[model samples]
Target: MRNPAFGHRADRTLPRYFYVLRNRDGEARLPVYWEPRPASRDPLVREVYRVRVAGRTLEAGNLHVLGDRLRDALGSLLATGQPPRFWLVNGACASPVYREGEAYVALTDGPRLWGKDLAELVGRYAHYLASCNGGRRAPVSVALFSPADLDVHWPELVWTGPGVWIPVFGVDGRLTAFGPRDRTWSVPAGPGAVLELWERVGNDLVACGLLQHPAALWGSEVSDSTRGALLASSEPTGLTLRFVHFHPSGAGRVTLPIRRLEGRVFASCGELSCLHVAPDPGTLREYLSAHLAQAGVVAGLQDVVLEEDGGASLHRLVRAERLPVGLASSHA
Candidate 1:
């Protein structure tokens, strides 16, 4: 059977071939390899290239690792020669086979490349290939997708929104806009409705976690303090929604009112003060870092919390709400 990791041959043509090379110390290393593109009517070349160890040849042991090495080597060679526009990997393992009179090889077990995790890996490989193909000036246009079309493109979630034009940061940490500027961030008309957008910084998608409905607007009888207490409490009665939008600097902008209540004893009856605080910058920064890490973009939170004191004095008390549970469940 042809190696699913590499490819097989048909009609005696080796369409594609890959080989692995190990150093004398038995450490796997990535290097360059070259071979003549096979003619259309030749059996596939099983041994594309050999690794030399002090004038001796090395043997292939682990086929999977070998395939990875071969891929890396081929990538390096392609960089020096006519680089490919883009490259992708399915992340599977299989043996190699040759065909009669075929110069090209085809990969088997292509189904292994199917799922969300595998698709992401394939995307990463494509990104690596693009980098090797050329400099940033000649960017390789590539798209990543899972086996099913229903799977949302990861970046798309962070870059685009419903009706609002928000800014989004690119993979390179530059900010860009999503949609046209004339669009308004509209909130649904209901007891508790809100609209949300997100900004992307690095690989992260940042947006407001939740926006209460019109009935839960800031101030009024349902004061921010009361809402905060309710949310923090074990039993949160208010309806909450999350909104996310991308920023131009690859960072996301999240806006939500922080509500908490404090009480003071008066000569007649105790008075209640409502306090509304903004999202914590530190928490936002941490969230962004975590999100980007999955995309192979590692970033530290430079600033997470941005505090704007509404000039209200209030005491801090944790409320018993299901919000924490909701967050945990969503992450899970």
Candidate 2:
């Protein structure tokens, strides 16, 4: 059976594939995979990666020390039983499968004494070694590969949101609205590139454990915090509701006080906010829904709350009698 790691993308164009699984000894064993991209050419330059050795200790607590162990694992043990002066491994034993913003490769069991697996291990470890400075993330260059022949397609890595986007193929592939502003930095626009780029990014994200989808809005922590408060204030506030649209940027919030005036919902959003008048709560829900979606997407919002504000990560507020009528999304 295809590795579940690949999920729906088991048919990607890689020439060879292996999973990063642990053996009975619990040591990290790797499959020797090598097919160098056009980036690294010199054998000495490749020493930064140990394209030869395969035995690695996965439980190294320190990421820096882990880099050292990786170098040793990929380096060659000479016939005289000595670590080499120049290097020994020189293939794609360690290349990354980029997922979300991070990279990961398949693990294997048994012998770590293969030359081919060196490529996969060396390339992946090099990336992990370059980073470890807490939250400061270093960027990486993306070179696209086709099948096993190793043709190079250089694309600008779109380091946005929680992950990276490489438009190896132009258009939306699986990702929508990823039109690179500067075309020169990305591959030429193509009919197939859009979907291809998005599909690859999406698939690899799941495989490498980098992509994250938040809980449904009501199921969110912010919602939980505000839920009880929302119900508690209902009888006290009458029908007037005060809501704060928490900006996603942590920049600030937009507070909107909504009330019914002559059977029409009238609400204002600060100085820049809009005046939304709807016939009923259902119609008002439609207006609020559109604006909320935009707020969540554009402003990078934290939450839509009932009025009271303050939290380590969230807050509370909102008024209805104390709700805005159709409170469909806030509870069970």
**Best lDDT goes to which candidate?**
2
What is residue 270's positional error in candidate 1, in angstroms? 44
What is the per-residue lDDT of model 1 for residues 1-332, given as tens digits with 9 covering 90 to 100?
Answer: 23244333333233233333333334323222324445525454433443322112333333455555545644543343422211232223221211113121222233222212222333334444445457332222222221111111212212212212222212222222222312223222221211122212111222242222211111212234223334443221122112232222332233233332222110000111221222333343344333333323333233223345343122323221233322322110
* Runs with alpha carbons beyond 4 Å of true place in candidate 1: 1-118, 124-128, 135-282, 288-305, 309-332
Which candidate's TM-score is highest?
2
Steric clashes per prediction: 65, 45
Q: Write the per-residue lDDT of candidate 2 for residues 221-269, one digit (tens) a residue.
A: 1112122332233222122223333322322334444443333333333
- What is the overall TM-score of model 1 with all chains considered together? 0.19
Off by over 4 Å in 2: 1-127, 131-137, 145-151, 156-189, 196-332
lDDT of 1: 0.27
Error of 1 at 84 (Å): 22
